[model samples]
Target: MSFFSKLFGGDKEAEKTALDLFKGLFGENAKKDDKPEDKPEETAQEDNTSAPADTGADTVSSGPSGDSWGDDMPAEDNQYRHEGAFWLYFEGIFDIEFAEYRYEKQVLTPFKRIVYTFYSGETKVLAVELMSERCSAYKFRNDCKKAGLAYTRFYIDHSGWWNTRSYVVRRMKEALN
Candidate 1:
């Protein structure tokens, strides 16, 4: 094990030398095997059972689904086109905070944008704040309806005024959709 132990004809070193000698005599690429530190690298075929992946640009398509992008937005939609930006934002919150919302479940979260919420077991809830007076509460409510989450509003006064608004959403129907 130790250098001193090996120098004194240790059993471990004797075993290693015998193995090396045998490998040198009959192993494939024996000349390469002379360097004891080197190991035979696995070919790609040996490493993966699946066929080689196609990486051509023409072959690959982008979106929420690798088959196509987000199904919510179509490929030809003018307002919501497939931009790489959405994927980056999607990947950022996915698994870390919003693992519940995935393709199979058909759940969406407001993580990258306004509110942050997801299905907690059976109940759907969201943590949302009204940032501006101009922002429509109805639009926010409809968004929550679309996602099947309860719409709970938390307001904070950032206009240097003293009116601060905050509350936890406890009601199933009133607070959420």
Candidate 2:
């Protein structure tokens, strides 16, 4: 099962539930009744034709170098940048207190990593670790569970970032209220 399926539910079920939730939150137009078969199929010749060329003049680039969508950096380098961005995004959305806690692993050389814990007033509500890769997310989730904390891992990828942000914001609002 996918991480989302594990986090939410089964694939189709989670998608349907999310769709229903969005429809309810955004109103009726969010729900689509149209199916693919409703549209007329194009001939094989039409399918073979090349798609329209991009003019490129209207394209907006917002990445570090204004040439990509910000995923070109090495995963390790991007992790800290993504984590800071995630912090700013949440801080802007909600009125809450954030504390940074370090977990130190003892080896020949002690390894210390920072994790962000968010509080709704006096109650520690959520612990978040922003990871550059999906594998790290699973490890972080396990670590948080072992620590007996409410945890959510946000990945640096666009979809993962947005999905996690939405889920965390909803949960944080509920916890605060």
Candidate 3:
């Protein structure tokens, strides 16, 4: 079902039931404000002034650069798929890009889904919609479990998810080769 349909489908009862189950199992409050206000917010800031500057300008960092949509660096696990094609993993803000594919509408699906298609001059890539916010990670994991597709985590709150698809296209050389 489409996201809008699921959202406005008047199935609040089921959603509530699921939320209750999650709350019971993880002790996670369905609503953030439900937590006691006793925990004080930490205003601590780390002093990075002493940190050494990066000396390697030639090295490409693994995050979005310029206007490109995928990472310049292919994934470390190269044997699974896209032996030569560039790989980009999206996480956090990158998930926002996947929202485009969630709807059955005018926009094209994300390129990361079926990146192998690019190897043969096919630009189309399949995108699977994640139904639940709480389960998106699990859903994406399960989706990748069914073979022929590659999977990589974006690693939010850490380092990962490089964006630069245009670089991938250039590297692929479909326009010149």
Task: List RMSD in Å for every model shown.
Answer: 23.9, 19.1, 15.8
TM-score of each: 0.25, 0.33, 0.21
Q: Counting only residues 3 or more apart in sequence or on different chains, how many pairs clash (N, Cα, C under 3 Å) in candidate 1?
A: 4
Per-residue alpha-carbon lDDT of candidate 3 for residues 1-177, written as tens digits (9 for 90 to 100): 644337547566555644443443345432335332221110101111232232222223355332221222222211112111122222222234343332221212221122122122343334322122222345554664574433333211111222233332233233223
After superposition, the stretches of candidate 2 with alpha carbons farther than 4 Å from their true spots are: 1-86, 96-114, 120-123, 158-166, 171-177
Q: In candidate 1, where is summed lDDT lowest over 10 consecutive residues?
A: 158-167
Worst 10 residues of 2 by lDDT: 39-48
lDDT of residue 10 for candidate 1: 71
Per-residue lDDT tens digits of candidate 2, residues 1-177? 655467566766555545543443345432245332221211100011232332222222243331112212212212212222333544444344223322221121111122556655566556655443323335655766787767654443322122223344554444334
lDDT of each prediction vs. the true structure? 0.33, 0.36, 0.29
lDDT of 1 by residue, 1-177 (tens): 655356546766445544543553456744532432232221111111233332222211233221111112212221112122322323343344445543222213221124545556655565443222224446766877797655554222112111111112122224544
Off by over 4 Å in 1: 1-113, 121-123, 158-166, 169-177
- Tell me the lDDT of model 3 at 93: 22
